[model samples]
Target chain A: MTTSNLHAEIARAIQAAPLLSPIANQLLQVTARADHEMKEVIDLVKCDSLLTARLLRVVNSSAMGLVHQISSVDHAVSYLGERLVVGIAIAECTNEFLGKPLDGYEGESGQLWRHELFTAIASRAVARHARAPLPADLAFTAGLLHDIGKAILSEFLRGTSRELVADIVRGDTADYLTGEQERVGLDHAEVGFELARHWKLPEALAQVIRHHHHPETAEAELRPLIYAVHLGDILAMMGGQGTGSDSMKYHLRQEYAEHFTMSKDDLALLLLECSEEFRKVEASLASLKET
Target chain B: MSQMVLGIGDLGASNHPDAEIKTYALGSCIAVVLLDPQTRTVGMVHIALPESKINLVKAKEKPGYFADTGLPLLLQEMARHGCQPKGKGLIIKLAGGAAIMDHNDTFNIGKRNLLAIKKILWSYGLGPRSEDVGGTFSRTVSVSVRTGEVILSSPGRPNWKI
Candidate 1:
């Protein structure tokens, strides 16, 4: 199929894809703003009783290890922070996409979610090292949704893992992203960008979903934030939390040095920290899966 | 037969003949597998980084997460299980330590991890008898306790004994 034809098929797929729940959409919009207050987030949660209850349940979940039950939504949201709140809301709305198996990559069900969760945590950590002020939570959100295109593109890529790997090995393609483009006429990043547009996600997040593999190409102002997610994505794969065959198949753009100042030791420490956080957060969010 | 799966920074040993020890999704991390055929004792540690000094606290809490700390702890666990490396009967095999495609060698963690493991083993007068390390792919490694058979697998690849 021609590249244009493939994009048209993906366009149709994005159109049929589920829209974010009202609460999730609102939460994302509110959190994307730099000056948004915790009150705004709490107010949004309070309006959706179901989300409020889920948030409270997660806060009091044994994974949280609370001494006493805190019944107030305000207390729960405060305790869990915006990241987990947004994570729960997004997971609630997009379980089908996040939880499904990536057959094209030979990934198991829930693997993609695990990878994204790790990336989200890692990206948040990387944001702290930005040369300029960057919203760590925004990076978290971007990381969480970075690979969403894979969920929709998996079926179209089914049974192509070997062919893709072979193409990469023989130098027919530079990397997995290129191999994906060569085989399917469109890469997951492009497809994900389309879905981001379909969901009307914040522009920063849409840019991240598209250029996370090559942050150098993103807009100069957004490059730092995109670099955070880019490094986070690599950190996830490096820590053994990849989706599947495409695990570490992408290139690590070295230009990240210009955006974030991290020495080798710093990178190692960040990986350690991300690994520790991923375990705790994954355990806490596993409750969301049960509900 | 029962199987025990090791996550990153985890280690375990078993003496049961009908046991299998495995670790999955080894990207740049390395799995150090130890087998003692006579006692049917097998052990594995999934090491995530080359050094422990980067995070001493985590090293103390999860020794299996770094090459320096985890390899020594795995050796200690083997000793506790009555499997000594002093004799030739002990077998060491390594897998994983894969690098992402990169020209600048930024985050050449896979190469660093492989070197670290080899250096640590050399200090202990031990080395891997077989290895399947350093690639751009993730690996799932397993070992059969009874047969001391080490098997390696990855997506779109056949299982091969290393």
Candidate 2:
């Protein structure tokens, strides 16, 4: 296929992002002034009691299902600390953002959130395997927010036609990117990347939006962690961990195994581990009511 | 004269010489397609992760866990099976990395994965004849043993014949 102009699309999205959502601005203010300092962030976080309640409820719910039962928000917070708290908060926030259907992703609604959550968990699992310094919670938080742009775009795609969805379901960054570039002069990925950057999400985290699709072209610093998220996404889709428009068809790179030194059995086992872990967490979190 | 199917980690490829070995829908994961004409041997790997830097025990348990640990074994598997790069002139083809992600997320494994694969291949002094790597869409790759012809297919388009 012809090469897609990621830069051009990114540029368009960057310019358009300011006109888009106030959420990016809101989150950035807290994260920046606070330097993402958890206490400060938590202070910002606390303002969203509904969000926190939702978060605590999910955490408590999921924990109850785990062999390690956690009953209270304070206990969960103390145990998981701020790192995981951010991930839970992100999950809580995005749940609303992705609540509507995404036209670009085949009218997928909340499917984005489900897909992202699975991917976030999977990213943490891979990070654990890689011995990356990122705690599973941190990796998960980054993974969870990796697709923030997509969430913003869902509103734009709210009432698009089935033909467009069909085209997207058919596939290609070109197909989906083209439509976005034509309409808003940028694709969601680029838009998402800019959103992440503006939010001052760690640059490493921002890279997820920039290169999640073309890991090969991602910034040099983010290759490994991005790869983990990538792998996590594949596993999540393959294992049916959540709903998504692109689940049934995909393959992995050979060097990933070579890069990580895992065999098929190893990959399979990792997948099993992810599933088991999610089940434990999900069982506990099932008590959470939607905000 | 022998048709060998190289199952490298999570990836598998068949060299029918008269047929093709194919893998589909690469998202964040990488698919390494290797073909040897003279040896009539072709193989592929559907690697799902980078390096096993996280849990070596788990990595050891699952061999398809890292490029460093898995690449050698793949070559060894090919060598042990007599599909060594002894002339049929090895051709490596790379594909996948369709993060296929939602509109707002980053989790960019596609771009990062292709980078890792490139580094490994460079270290090994090998690369694919062609590739359709990275995008928001999935891809399918098929290699014909007889002609060493590789075909890739994705949604909304026909198989990319090369």
Best by lDDT: 1
Off by over 4 Å in 2: A1-56, A66-74, A80-84, A131-135, A154-185, A241-244, A248-259, A280-286, B1-162
Tell me the whole-model lDDT of each prediction, alpha carbons only: 0.88, 0.57
Separate DockQ for every predicted complex? 0.71, 0.03
lDDT of 2 by residue, B1-162 (tens): 443333224544454546556664455566777776656666677665566665577468655545656665566555654676331356777777655444212245456557777777777777667887766555556676677766776543445764
Interface RMSD of each: 1.5, 9.4
TM-score of each: 0.96, 0.50
lDDT by residue for model 2 (A7-98), tens: 55444554554331333334434442323555564555456666466556665553554466555555656665554455555544444565
What would the C-alpha RMSD of candidate 2 be, to one decimal place? Answer: 12.1
Tens digits of per-residue lDDT, candidate 1, A220-239, equal: 98899899999999999988
Kindly report the TM-score of the first chain in candidate 1.
0.97
Fnat of the models, one by one?
0.69, 0.01
lDDT of 1: 0.88
